[model samples]
Target: METEDDVPLHLKSLAAFLIRHHSDQLRSITLSPDPKLHYPLYIDFAELMNEDPPLAHLVFSHPIDYLRFFDDAALWAHKIVFDKLKFEKAVEKIFIHVRINISGSPLECPETFPSIGHVRVKHHGILLTLKGTVIRSGATKMYEGERTYMCRKCKHMFPVYPELETRNSIVLPPSCPSQRSKPCEGTNFHYVENTIICHDYQEIKIQESTQVLGVGVIPRSTLVILKDDLVDIVKAGDDVIVTGILTAKWSPDLRDVRCDLDPVLIANHVRRTNELKSDIDLPDDVIMQFKQFWLEFKDTPLKGRNAVLRGICPQVFGLFTVKLAVALTLIGGVQHVDASGTKVRGESHLLLVGDPGTGKSQFLKFAAKLSNRSVITTGLGSTSAGLTVTAVKDGGEWMLEAGALVLADGGLCCIDEFDSMREHDRATIHEAMEQQTISVAKAGLVTTLSTKTVVFGATNPKGHYDPDQSLSVNTTLSGPLLSRFDIVLVLLDTKNPEWDAVVSSHILAEGEPGKEKDEHLAHIWPLAMLRRYIHFVKGYFRPVLTKEAEKVISSYYQLQRRSATQNAARTTVRMLESLIRLAQAHARLMFRNEVTRLDAITAILCIESSMTTSAIVDSVGNALHSNFTENPDQEYAKQERLILEKLKSFEEFPDIISME
Candidate 1:
């Protein structure tokens, strides 16, 4: 009974194509039982539109209307394929979804392409493409789409589709459909819980990638709803491009004046974009400049490495050792799995404890910007659950959510105000730091997640830094925790007039006009190029320690152990491991295939400098006069006894010692 105008042109054409190629699509679907892999037919929208100009014009003009007709056409194709396959009763339960891939001409259409932040009410029911980072993902659950209701008076069964706009509300038919002489009151409708068709549903929050936004601007996020085969397609921290329709849901509670429910994207197809590289598109000239930089620095890797180090936080003057260590930490060592199934973490962990105005937070923020996958968190704000993983109740079911460390997996996690964190929260990262894995046993969920995160922790010392206090005492950190870090650098505000003058000059120069154009300024990589360089090294290079490098490292370890005046608890096997890791990282920075003796020496020098700055050793490389001694707590007692003995000796000379 439908007229020609009532039916969309694209829908009729799509039906004809499905009837023609029904067997081919059905064969592809039957091969894969997994819902994720069950996407057998991918209708290329661009190709279809190109073959039919009228259909393309109709689609381009009325996209939202065409999308609804397209869904119906896909459903009709699904039925045709399902019937042709003659699938078993059990197999029929698994619905094979038909996904539409938009590329070429369709992607060029302005109406189909919209930024995540630009989606509005005008875009409702319109199919659009969006690219963003998945910030949060909810657990998949079965949602009842259609429910059967029975009339209590006549026991008449009726099926109804509930509107899921508001939080918790269901709409029923005004009256029963039974052809009774007397009209039945809609109030007597009883819910039939058993007869319901449930579909897999999930919600995810996608935020604009940092690369797309201007510096210092906060990213915007949008809620996306996935149903049936699309549920659980993506996870947190994934950069994805989704093709879906913009839809809005109404608030369930009509009494509430404020409508809290926002428009959500109902996704049909999701594709993961590579996150290892910078998402920002660069100009042709800028890309060429990066290639030229690589060519110029390919022979002299050490020079290139130094340039990169100096470039990071140039405003913060004079912490060469700390800067170098941070640079190496950014390009971490190679992960290795031994024959015995032991996995050694390749990531480097650095802890910076310094004076109040020494730019510790600045370093952390710079590192976050430099790395492609990085997260910055503070001690006061982050919790044990927030750092690793936590269980949350979503749709009446407990779902595991990823935290900062988990979300920053295979990348960097910068923690500012490290000392201000609670002891309980700090204890949670013990396993994650050493083993590179977080084990969660909460809410009846027992699972271990891979962290693979390099920790960059910055802290302030307790009150004024005392040279007499050990690193642990100064920072209020445990000995075990301190030992885990590959390098612990301390920055002090010393009274060197000459050094202070140099720092002052640099600070003053920053405010001057045309300072960026000064030829005297150190040559540093651009932010985009620097990020790309890091990604290149991490992805392609995996340097191993040579025999000479191994010998150098072994000799240094033995020498440190033999010259120990006090029992060096800090000097453990972990230190030796850290030494090797640093050496490997150094080699990677230089674009070398193997760690040389010079790399090992550089690593040792870095460790020695860190130890000296931390006040663990004196200027001449000897242990300081403090704890790590035999009975350190008894020092006060020893001092008191000596005082008493001295007083007794002075008993004979009462006139020399006057008593008030």
Candidate 2:
């Protein structure tokens, strides 16, 4: 039977053209000794087909046959270069990876490509493209290309190179070729050890990207196989465009009727899609709406910023400061990387600790929906491994599987019920929160995975809010963990009849049809436009603090330090950094190039609200007082003087003082 290694007659001409015109490119690839340095030779399929009329007709009419022929041609071209170079030791290392770019083709268009839900058996053996997010990636392992089997009865050795179409099928040779006393059936053949040629292999699971899925529809995923140079190219949560051939294999266990078999993509090329690319092109109508909004609020930046805060979670009533903080968390500060390769993360982390019915969960869900890429999980259902990374057995070898935090890299990770998470699981996020990376040292795999994700956690306080309890104690979180958050807003279910009536009216108005036409509500940008505006800010805006802003922030920090009590939840340098981040975010909201003093003052006010509510202060009727008294040295000195005066008076008039 003909095999894949046999080059077809029609492909020989293509092979000749590749050797004649692309010899230098092949030579350079062969000279690179490192496998990691290997780069695929990109070829334009349209251009190649235009050069060869016969090949063009065959490729369009019979794609599968043309693909096989193209593979053979690539192999032949590589062999010719190997012979010409005279690099005998490197001949086997020189692999020709042909990546065909199918531009402007209907089959290769992202919109026309079949989703995992629409894929069927008819798609097998055809070239296609897929767009999705990688949910899981298996460890790279060696895949056997050619195997040698030895018969036990006659000790006869036979070589077999499995075809790509039937690579996963379970089949053994019918009979052995040894001329023994009786022909031995090769039923008891054993694989010869150390006689197999292997290639690099990895498997990844891809789920449909969120933008491609319909509303309220759960995403579907499919397995993809990547070999050789393509292994280890992508990680979980990466949005990718994959171009490859679809192939199906028999089930590992034939008795399993529920899942008999499934198709897998053998990826020929993979490209990472820009996560923020969709934000650049806002719809014309939405842009016009935003322009009108700008016109209304252009005179007052503060009014425009408050409008954005109100638009974040319009359904929830009366937490304007908390909503503003959340908005800043979404539009993060500028990340700084110095010459020494040290990186300072600019993404802000927020924690919302509230009463049972204070809309914490609703706000979290709203934030998750607004972000372009986000993952939502509850602490009760989450594990340490599930939040970070876990080692799992695949094909008798351990593989590293990405968790929620890892998968949410470069996005937001919303962990609801933060107080409900186990102690160990809660501790697992410390490194990720501070360093912005996760380090895995399990199953002999030692690698650091980037988790540049903004963590937005929400939890209910323990029982009721007590004046004596600090924020950390109320939330059941340690001081070290609590200090990592840039802002910790405490939401109380305060009862005010006037405020309650307003909230009730807003809730009722939401169900009414004409409420949106109100003049007051007209200035608020549509939810879609608001989300795209945030994305645009994050992509383009990186605000720096001016001298005035820096001075204001410094003064506020010093004042807080002087007033802070020993039991204050967050009084460290992290708070100072948080102030800077908030100020930068505020500037970004106004589309300003630099943070002004007004921005710093706005940030300070938000921080003070969070600190005062979360901490326990002893001052009488002073809401802004930190949990500690100011000027402790002066108070102690005054007490000492009063004690001295009393002692002197007691000594001078002992008889009259009634010493008893």
Top candidate (lDDT): 2
> What tens-digit string does per-residue lDDT give for candidate 2 at 418-471?
999999899999999988999889989898988999999999889887646778
For each of the candidates, the C-alpha root-mean-square deviation to the true structure, in angstroms, is 12.7, 11.1
- What TM-score, to 2 decimals, does candidate 2 have? 0.76
lDDT for predicted candidate 1 compared with the true structure: 0.70
Candidate 1 minimal-lDDT segment of 10 residues: 620-629
User: By how many angstroms RMSD does model 2 differ from the true structure?
Assistant: 11.1
lDDT of 2 at 629: 24
Which lDDT tens digits does candidate 1 get at residues 572-644? 7888889999998888766667897658766876677557442123321211111112332243245334322
Give the Å error, residue 557, model 1: 2.7
